[model samples]
Target: MATDVSNELDRADNVGRIVDSLDSRRVLLGALGLVGFVGLWWAGSTAQPEYILPSPLAVGLAAQSELASGTMQAALFNSVLHWLPGTVVGTTLGIATGVALGWSRFLDEALTPIVRVLRPVPPLALIGFAIAWFGIGHAGAAFIIAIGAFWINFYAAYGGVEGVSEDLLDVARSLGVQRQLGLIRTVVLPASLPEITTGIRTGIGRCWMLVVAAEIFGAPGIGRQIFRASNSLQVDRVIAYILVLSVMFLLVDTAFRVVQRRVLAWR
Candidate 1:
């Protein structure tokens, strides 16, 4: 037993070392890619007018100014106001609805057709209804973002539930877990968690992209900042806000992935 345990530990240590080496190489390559991209951008900016393509330093200065003036902070706060609520509501409802439809033959039969029809409708197409219903504010922007998140999560959860092992469910039933809710809670949900989490991660990224579209009709956010700056020929400011959006997405994604790794540690 001791020999087996030592062998396992050694194998695990080797795997960890390999992973760390790969991660280090990945970081180095990523840094090189970023440097190449920045060099290209600098060369392009030097050839173009500032109004057409701002230099990296100009965009950085603009970002610093926005930060110093507190406009960026306010915009970030407002963006979060809608982004958070929309993502939460959409993810919750989508998972519930998807699980129901996937688990129940009747619901699947009744709703699959309707879902197929509605699935292709673009969230942007709802901007008019959002304006009319929620009226040019955070609520309206959230509605649009929710639509985007809903579809992504819905498909993810539905597929997850569908892919659950029949043998596992049968084993649970044989063990006296017969209640529908109990079966779902103990077996179905745990089995489907990976796909559901993947959906959530994807939904988060898509919703971030939708933030810009959501704010197209006059909501206050980074998207609004970009719009306003673009209209005034402020290319530097526009690039600055775009960078802000990129950084925010990276931060949120990194944070979520950390939590996801912890949650799925058993895997």
Candidate 2:
């Protein structure tokens, strides 16, 4: 009788696991959502002139043409060279500054005022400085992106540390890790990871938005490509570039999610 009961329980657990599996209903639902979205877009385009609202196919064709002409490649390379450097510089500096401020009361008090004053200013507002300093090239574009990324990571790191529980610090102390660096590594850093990751993800999207604007400032990139297309009234190319930009951002977001899941697998 006990053997029979155990078999029944095991079968029930297996059934539950199958039902809760990720690729089952979740994949189906996600596919359905994409279909519905594209269907709505198709309907909307059908109701408008192709020039005003190009169909997905039209944009795809434009993308093909751009790729064939090497326009897409050049623009992508130009944008990447600057955007990547800026993000790296910004994220690194912001995290370091934020951690320092969070860990030390003196530093927090000394820096908070200046950070607050600068934080409200938009990257666009700093274009003059960027151009003056970097001479309207990749360096200028990178500087703009860096300014945006810095703030995001800074707040992420700062808030993550601030949000760590006092109990966690106590636990670290009890573990005989009383030094500041040890406390950060053993308690504060781990405890604050979720918030820090959130900040990085948020920054990724924000930086992409800024990319177009940053590129508009005499930089040779996707933004310039779109703008130049508009000069000749090539709305199809404009739409295609917009689609390309969306795809790029989506890819980055997906990659970040994958990395995030792996890093936070413990949770």
Please report the candidate that would top lDDT against the real structure. Answer: 1
Query: Where does candidate 1 stray beyond 4 Å?
Result: none
List model 2 lDDT by residue over 128-225, tens digit each: 99999998988999999998989999989999999899987898799799688999888888888888888888888888777889988789998889
lDDT, candidate 1, equals 0.94
Best by TM-score, which number? 1
* Model 1: how far residue 105 lies from native, Å: 1.2
Clash statistics: count for each candidate = 0, 0
What TM-score does candidate 1 get on C-alpha atoms? 0.97
Listed in order, each prediction's TM-score against the native is 0.97, 0.88
lDDT of 1 by residue, 1-267 (tens): 999999998999999999999999999999999999999999999999999999999999999999999999999999999999989988988899889998999999999899999899999999999999999999999999999999999999999999999999999999999899988998989999999999999999999999998999899999999999999999999999998889999999999999999988888
lDDT on C-alpha atoms for all candidate structures: 0.94, 0.87
